[model samples]
Target: MSDEPAGLVRPDRRRPEPLWHQAEMALRDLIDQGEWAPGLQIPNEDRLCEMLGISRITLRHALRNLEEAGMLRREHGRGTFVRSATMVAGVRGLTSFTDEMQTLAVSPGTRLLLAQVISATREIAEALEIAEGDSVVQLRRLRLGNGQPIGIQTTHLPSARVPGLFEAASDVTSLYRWLKDNAGIVPVKAKEVYRVGAVAAGDASDLELPVGTPAFEVERITFDQRSPFEFAVSTMRADRYEIRSTLYV
Candidate 1:
């Protein structure tokens, strides 16, 4: 097929890198560069071995590495195919959904689900550090990556802190960007808690996932230079999203 890797250079034994590692890197580049797009079945093992001038052992090793890294999936009878890119969010950096997608070279989009002025519930009030029954602008949105639904986020902001937010909600693609530009709420930090759970019925429909599918439930409280600025809860597709962290010994 046209999407198959072409003009592949055989690994040089003179180089320090191992043969399998070199083959692995070459295939990774094809997937990352979108030359071999998601869902495209790759060339057969025998053909790839011939093309790369490698043995079945070396080719299989390279393929195994890619499969473990979530770049390819193998079918029992069918050949291996490239998997769609998974969106990775770090527990370390505080970045907006739009920024994250852009950094990964994916187009980001938002579909507003619900927007209204509401009285803050006790939980919402505490998260925003405001009084109970205070006015709050509530916005529910479906977050998209590459035009596909990836997450559903419900956000609450104090009305006093974000005047006219309800009216402008539909046009707000990124909550962080909107807060900084219009409400002067520059989020400097955030605390996020994650839980693994099954998707709710309504949310599953919005996220285009089967009911009771695995998902990531995240609750976050964002802070500005002054104080708490926004509170958000998100349901993200487990298959399409990942949370990453770094550790020190």
Candidate 2:
């Protein structure tokens, strides 16, 4: 009798599903059942192929599907490891990171990477509707969903509009919540631009993605009833994050 793990058992040839799909399902079950815990590297490709009784090409196809689905993460030089579920956010409306995660029933977390007062550059000034060289509070943060790093975001806000923000930086988890409570600022509308790009070398480590990996560069201008109050840029992991939209024709 074979004593191999059930989740790693070979797929039945008589089944209707393709071999690659069967391999994908079997691997997913292994991860989901905690037979392969998160952050634990799975068997090497050669061994996995032997256990699953699938060819190298077939196994590679299955692995790619799992990576795209966020069930596994593949490091350039290292082996693949089980990972947390992917996070999906709707771009149809303006929502805070905290709000997005909560809606998805995932715990949201933020780590402040940098916070200081800086002069707004021409680009930032234009987006915030402020004068160039004007004082703005610059905040760089690492955003997490379910304890996994997902994005690196930087925001610039007109310092004159929100007094004492610098002193209270340590307490901020949600910028939107802080703005609303401290300065009565609420976003009436926002315009966002998304560009497909590669992750920068410096930011790749923070986001747990390889340098040159696909990423989304998002720029947003947020307005209150009075004026544009914030300008933000985010580099989010393409594997861990997705933007969903509903369309009607």
lDDT against the true structure, per candidate, is: 0.86, 0.86
Which pairs clash in the backbone of model 2? none
Total residue pair clashes for candidate 1:
0
Candidate achieving the largest TM-score: 1
Scanning candidate 1 in windows of ten residues, the lowest lDDT window is 1-10
TM-score on alpha carbons, each prediction: 0.75, 0.69
Residue 113's C-alpha lDDT in candidate 2?
90
Q: Candidate 1: which stretches are off by over 4 Å?
A: 1-81
Shift in Å, residue 182, candidate 2: 0.5
lDDT, model 1, position 117: 93
